[model samples]
Target chain A: MYLIITALAAAVATAFWYKNRLNDKLHLGALCLMYWGAALMWLVDCVAAIIAGEEEIIDTSLNAALLGICSVALGLAIWLILLLIRSRRNKSQATSINSH
Target chain B: MACFAAPLAEAVITTVLMKRFEKKEKMTDAPNESQAGIPWSRKLKWLNNLLWGGSALLALEHIWHGEIIPQFPFLTALKEPGGVLPMLGEIATVGVGMAAFVTLVWFFMIKIADARAKKAAVSGKTAETEPCI
Candidate 1:
């Protein structure tokens, strides 16, 4: 479920990036990369499950999902931290401009 | 079903809100050349926030359900009857629906922004550039 959701999100983000490639920014590209990375990780897990057979596929998939969720969460955290720093810098710039 | 629906719904709602806020920001922030052509960056930021917020909520939900134990092979809770199939089904339905919704909204936003730009051009406010994506 997490896999499908992130994959879908990644697809949408990628399309947006493609259409606006000339004007793309680092953070946006990072976001697309993050979701695509998560989706790819889950895809590997799915492949592993196929190799493991039915008896172990369930356990393997569950573990994979957990790891996928964790990775997504970590990616989000990093993005948010970056966003906050950017916003703060922008704020300070604006304040200096106004004071001048 | 609701379990999966929760994250999908959250993602959509957050994306909408973030997009709205970004639009407001663009309007107030003066049309700099650097920002003018990069409308998709705002959309990307919104989508990033949605994904991050949704993932965090889902993690908390999993923890509440006791699916995140410290033991090896954690998430044994998902091995219950019916397993992850139902959850996957719900995610598929909701994810597709939300994706379609966001796409439609994005298309409309571009359309409107283009129209407004054309109007500006006609009124001699600004020269018409390429349509924003």
Candidate 2:
């Protein structure tokens, strides 16, 4: 199970990384794949910890909360990075045009 | 301890990188995109830093309460299985966990940035500059 999750995460990450290089980018698909990868890893790890009898590895209620927060944070990070790149380019272009 | 240290260091490095990027943006003729010096992306760094810190706390809990310590020991605190110290060392494995978490965040950010940059470049917004007369 753990290996399956790891393999899935690795595959998705690799796909997105490759998609980034493609001329016709499939960003939304990449984003979905990335989240699925993360979710799978998290799920597998949590289950492994349970099987190992280290259920305390991540205190259940708190772990769930943290996972939610982490997901939101991940999304925010992605959103902001895209915005930054876009705005940076916009600003650069505006400045050039104004000066011209 | 070692587990938490790495993520914390990565956060610091990322924070420093963001600051440097901001300074460079300010020095250049970059358009102000109307959003002051602070980009929303910085929020992501802050969020990641918080998550790393939180995970470190979780790791500590596991170490303090987990079986590893009871499994092995330097000196036989408990003659049978062992002292908690040797088992506690397994907590160091949390470092690998932390790395995995951080990598996920880094990859997401990088992917997003790359996509945006590529989009801009393809739109010809970046490659062709209007005369800054």
Q: Which model scores highest in DockQ?
A: 2
Query: Model 2, which residues run further than 4 Å from truth?
Result: A1-100, B1-5, B28-91, B124-133
For candidate 1, the TM-score is: 0.36
* Model 2: DockQ score: 0.06
lDDT, residue A41, model 2? 36
Question: Which one is best on lDDT?
Answer: 1
lDDT of 2 by residue, B51-104 (tens): 443343333333543422545441233344554454345334544555456567
The 10-residue segment with the lowest total lDDT in model 1 chain A: A37-46
Mark the 10 consecutive residues where model 1 chain B has the least summed lDDT.
B124-133
Docking class of 1: incorrect
Look at candidate 2 and give me any clashing residue pairs: A91-B31, A92-B31, A99-B132, A99-B133, A100-B131, A100-B132, A100-B133, B68-B87, B69-B84, B69-B87
Name the lDDT value of residue B84 in candidate 1. 69
Q: Model 2, residue A81: what's the lDDT?
A: 69
Each model's DockQ score: 0.04, 0.06
